[model samples]
Target: MAKEIKKVVLAYSGGLDTSIIIPWLKENYNNCEVIAVSGDVGQGTELDGLEEKAIKTGASKLYIEDLKQEYIENYIWPCLKADAKYEDYLLGTSHARPCIAKRLVEIAKAEGADAICHGCTGKGNDQVRFELAIKAFAPDMKIIAPWREWSIKSRDEEIDYAEAHNIPLKINRETNYSKDKNIWHLSHEGLDLENPANEPQYNKPGFLELGVSPEQAPDEPTYVTIHFEKGIPTAVDGEELGAVELVTKLNKLGGANGIGLLDIVENRLVGMKSRGVYETPAGTILYKAHNVLETITLDKETFHYMQSQIAPKMADLTYNGQWFTPLREAIGAFVDKVNENVTGDVKLKLYKGNVINAGVTSPYTLYDEEIATFDEDEVYDQKDSAGFINLFGLPIKVQAKLKAKNSAE
Candidate 1:
C-alpha cells in the first residue's frame, strides 16, 4: 500500500528525466497536484518555454526562481577562495545541486506540499546532494525519488514510457547524453562517456558545449587580466563588472581560447567511480587567476596550509553534499581570513588548454625582489643562514656523533 500523497513539489528542469516525471507522478500518486520548481541558476535560454511545457505536461504551476546570485556568491565563491577542486575535477554539478535543492525545499514549504521529488537517478551523486539539502532545510518532508521506486530501469524504458504517454521528447537514443548546465559549467555524462576507454569526440559537432577542444583553438593566444577584491573576481580587462557579468565575460573569453575542458574519472559519494566531461570556462579562468594572485598576497605558511589542508577537505565536503554543515562554514571563516589581503590583478595567456600566468600584482605582496635576490643584497644576510642550517640539522649531527662514539668504544 502506497502512502497517500496529495501534492508534491518537484525540482524540475525541462530535461528528459524531469519531463517524464510529471506524468509518472500523476499516474502513481493518485493524480496528485504537481508543483514544478526550477531554480534559474544561470541556465539562460534553457528557461524559455519551460512554464508552457510544464503546464502542457500536467503540472499545476511552475515556479522559476532566479538563484544565479546566490549560486555564484554563496556556493562558487567560497569554493574558489578555498581553492577546492575534487581530484583535479572542477565541482560544477556537485555544488549546483544544493543551490537548486535549497530553492526546491523553500517552494515545497510555501506551497504546502506533502512530499518533494527529484529526477536524479539512483546511481548518481545528485540524489545525495538534493536529499541532504532537503533534510537540512525541511527535515520532515518526505522525499519521493522516482528512480528508486519506479519500475523504469533504463533510459530505453523511460523513452518507451514517454512515447506511450504521448510526451514529446527532444532527445532520442542516438543524440542522448545526460547533461547539466549552469552559468559556471556544463557537464556531460552517460552514452559513450560511460566507458573510460573511449576518448571524448571533442571535434564532433554538438559534443562540446561551453568551449572548443585544444585542436580547434586559434593560433594566436588570448590574454586576460582578472581583477580580484578579497578573492572575488570584480573585473576583466580593466572593466569592473558585477559577479554575474564577470563570470559571463570570462566564459566567452576563456571558451574562445579553448580553456576549461576537463575529463576525469572521479570517485562519487555512492562508492563508485564515474567518468564525465566537464566544460567550465569561467570557473577555470577564475581559479587560475586567483591562484596567481594568492602566490603574492598570502604568506608561505598560510598559502601552504590552505593548499594542503583546507583545499582537499573543502573539495570532499562540497562533493559529499555537506555544504550547509558547520565545519564547512567554519572552514569558510578561515578561508575568508586568509583572503583578506588577496586583492590583486592576474594576467594570463590562454592558448590551447593552458592558462599561463602572464603577470601578477598585489597591493599586499610578500614577494620582495630584494630579499629573494641571489646577488649581494643588504636586505638579507646570506652568511647568517649557516647558523640556522647548523641548528636545524643538530639532531642529525648528534645522532652521527653518538654512532661514531659507540663504534670507537
Candidate 2:
C-alpha cells in the first residue's frame, strides 16, 4: 500500500517526458490533481501553448514563471565568475536544473501541494540534481519520480502509453534526440549520440538549434567586444545591455560564426558515462572573454590558484546540484572578492567555431610594460638577478657538492 497523495506539483517543460507525466501521475497517485510548473529560462517559443497543452493533458493549472533574468544574473553569472566547467564542458544543463527545481519547490508550496514530481529518468544525472535541490529547499515534500517507479522501459513505451491515454505529444517514434534547451545552452542526447563511435551529423539539417555548423558559417570572421564590470558582462560591441540582452546578442553573433559546439562522453553522477552534444554559443564566448579579462586583472597568485584549484571544485559543486549549500555560497563569496578588480573589455574574433582573443584592456591591469620590456628601464637593475639566482639555487648547489664529496671519499 502506498501513501495517498491528493495533489502534486510537477516541474513541467512541455517536453516529451514531461508531456505524459501529467497523465501518468493522475493514473497512479489515486487521481491526484496535478499542477504544472514551467520555468522560462529563455526557452523562447517552447513555452508557447504550454498552458493549453498542460490543461488538456489533465493538469489543474499551469504556472509559467519567467526566470530568464534570474537565471542569468544569479545562476549563470556566478558560474561564469567562478569559471566553472566540468571536463571542459560548459555546465549549461547542469546549472539550469537547480534554477528550475528551486522555482518548482516555490510553486509547490504556494499551490498547497502534498508532493513534487519530475520527469527525470532514473538513469540520468537530472534525477539527482532535481531531488537534491528539492531536498535542500523542502525536506518534507514527497518526491515522486515516475521513471523510477513506473514500468515504462524505453521512450517508445512511453510514447505508446501517452497515445493510449490520449495525451497530446510533440514527439514521435521518429524523434532522434533527447534535448534540453535554455537561454544558457542547448544539450542533445540519445539516438546516434548514444554510440560513442558514431560521429555527430553536424552537416545534417535541423541537427543544431542554436547555431550553424562551422563548415556552413561564412568565410569572413566576425569581431565582438564584450565589456565586464566585476566579472559580470555589461555590454557587447559598444552597446550597453542587461544580462539577458547581452547573452541573447552574443548567442546570435557566436552562433552565426559557429562558435560554441561540443561533443563529449561525460561521467554522470549515477556512475555511468553518457555522451552529449552541446551548443553553448553565447556561453562559450562569454567564458572566453571573462577569462581573458581575468588574465590582466587578477594577480599572478590568485589567478593561478583560481584556475588550478577553485575552478574544478566549483564546477563539481554546480554540476552536483549543491548550489543551495553553504559551501557553494562561500565559494561564491570568494569568487566575488576576487572579481572586485576584474573590470575590463575583451575583443575577440569569431571564425569557424574559434574564439580568437584579439585583445584585452583594463584599468586595473597589473602588467607593467617597463618592467616586462627588454629595453633598459629605470625601475631596477637586471644585475640583481645574479644574487637572487645564487640564493635560490643554494640548496641545490649544497646537495651537489655533498654528493661529489661523498663519492671521492
lDDT of 1 at 402: 100
lDDT score of model 1?
Answer: 0.92
Q: Which residue runs of candidate 1 sit more than 4 Å off their true CA positions? A: 1-3, 402-409
In model 1, the Cα lDDT at residue 193 comes to 95
Per-residue lDDT tens digits for candidate 1, residues 136-221, read: 99999999999998999999899998888888787898988988899999988899999999999999988887888989999999
Q: Write the per-residue lDDT of candidate 2 for residues 1-409, one digit (tens) a residue.
A: 1447998999999888898899888888888899999999989988989999999999999999999999899889998999989997898888888899999999889888899999999889889889999999999999999998989999988888888888777676776489889998989999988999999888888889899999999999999999999999998988999999999999999999998999999998789899999999999999999999999899889999999888999999988888889999999999999999999899999999999999999999998898989889999788999999999999999999999999999
C-alpha local distance difference test of each model? 0.92, 0.91
- Stretches of model 2 off by over 4 angstroms after superposition: 1-3, 406-409
